[model samples]
Target: MQVLFITGQNQYGVVSHFLDGMREDLESVGVRTDSLSVESEQHIHRDLPQLLPLQEYDQLISFNGMGLHLEQAELSVPQYLKQRPVWVFCVDHPMHILKRIIGLNVILLCVDEEHVSFAQLCGFNARLFPHAIGKQQLANTSMMPLEDKSNEVVFPVSYMDSGSHRQALTPYWSQIGHWVEQSRSVTRFMQFIGVLPIGNRPASLTLNEQILRLCVTVDSYLRAKQREACLHFFAQQNVNLTVIGRNSHCYQSIAPTHQYLNAMDFTDLQQKIAAARYVVHNSPGFERGLHERVIYPLALGTLVLTFETPYVNQTFPQVCLDAKQSSGQISDKEYQQRRKQAHQQIEQQHCWHHQLRKLFTSPTTSPDSNGRTR
Candidate 1:
């Protein structure tokens, strides 16, 4: 079977790399693949008819919901999309783009299990599909002896302060904050938001749509808070730390002494991760999913020090640690063994070749049975 990847420009610049890796992996497994670049929503209206001949491709896959704005596109565009299976590989929380996806004939391949539940709640078809390590990540670095790797810790993260968002949602801060603090998991947070009353919602949006917008705002705020707290905790430890990614300088107040480098491309970031002894990661509101940030380092033979999430605690208990719990030192022998095990696990289950094969072979539900249509 052949698949067409619907791609577009994104701020993070990692989507293209992900598509490239997925295409290569799929091809290796004998699944033909191609790509369609839709620069914007207008392109979907103007270019899709002549460019996208659905018969040639058995399926269409989009990263982060790119080129799937059926709500805004011309009727013909959505009509074409409905003719075949369309799958969106959501790399972020589904709440962020739920409005655009509602009433569309598309399946959501979510990176987190909680995301799946959230989509299902909205009457959409969603699957739990975690991010996979690319071949480039593995090829960029070899497993060095634990003692030979530098003692430095590398954190590849983008810093965003949520102060403004909190201020903007001042009236709902108390309720939102309580939900964030009291909710044990993402699913619980969703349940809390579902009951929240937003009287000031615009007439153009339905209650559920307004609630989803609030959820996105609150989720971003919580992630910023968590990242700041993690950075402060690391600062107190006085270990050699390097922060890489966009807006690294914004972390000055939290981690003044730590080295900061501007964001680099994926390959360069992988090289930095490979040279480090440990990679520190903060989940962006994922309670039951592994981010590529957490997976790539492990695949490159570097130990990951991340917040204690359910998925991580269960899958990589050896590397899971919360702010209250110390990361604690590991002996070289133990470190090497952990790295070996992590690498083996990634190769077996978290590689693109394995994930794509499973996805393509799996049975899909009919759109009529999955959810409502526009």
Candidate 2:
């Protein structure tokens, strides 16, 4: 069946953009798909309220930022779905999903057992579709070593609101960050390896970070007498952090363990993230559930260092750490073990082969089955 990814990549579509790239992975496995970005094509604007690009899609996969106006706006989610069976994918906060569910046919979820308990309280069909790191680099472990890398660490920045980001991990950021700080020395990372940076500001209210800079200078200002101590420690250690994706956010003042590299396309971002020593991710917000940013790190076979989130615990339990307190800890051996486990799990459960298997084996597509959408 043909699937249409009806989405917006502008002002309101920041987080929504996370789920759109799955189309590439899906297509690699034989799924016919088209991604309709609200901010890209001129026709989308000319179509005026009628965003339907190519004709008849067997299914329309709606991301967040879709339906609140999903059904109301011009060339919006709701308008496109009315013509066919639309599955409202909800990996975001329950409140948003609940709002979109008002007239949607189905509420698709990327939930885990831990979160499902919470989902029950919100009263939506929060199911566990799980997320894959899009299969592109599931086995690309041949990464290059850095030169004179003082710190063998990687901290990719997120565009999430600084306040919401810290709040989500208030339960565990320091503890996790600290352990990561202590986990490696000069030998392990040899040099810090940061990954893709997005445009700070797009030409429009879009995802291009072409014009953004780090809030405080990324240099000494990044580590003052009383900021997150873990970050300060890295700076103090003279770490060599290589910023990727090349956003204008000049952390240049921070004297990051290293220099920023040239920009990369999204696919290269996946490859580089997979090659890094480790990636540090903040947890999802209270209202927003698991975000897809976390998975790419895991898929890359890079050990993940982030505030623990329920989704990660359920999917790649062995390949990560959940640092719950400012000073809590987990072992280097444990970290290593979990990292290996994450790699194995991705190969088994998260590869594109598995994705294709699920599609063909699902109720309607199964050989012995009657036609029905799961």
- Stretches > 4 Å off in candidate 1: 40-52, 69-77, 135-141, 145-148, 174-177, 180-187, 195-207, 319-328, 363-374
Name the top lDDT candidate. 1
RMSD vs true structure, all candidates: 5.1, 13.1
TM-score each candidate. Answer: 0.84, 0.54
**Tens-digit lDDT string for candidate 2 (337-364):** 6666766777677654464455444664
Per-candidate clashes come to 0, 28
Which residue pairs show collisions in model 1? none
TM-score of 2: 0.54
Distance (Å) between predicted and true CA of 62, model 1? 0.9
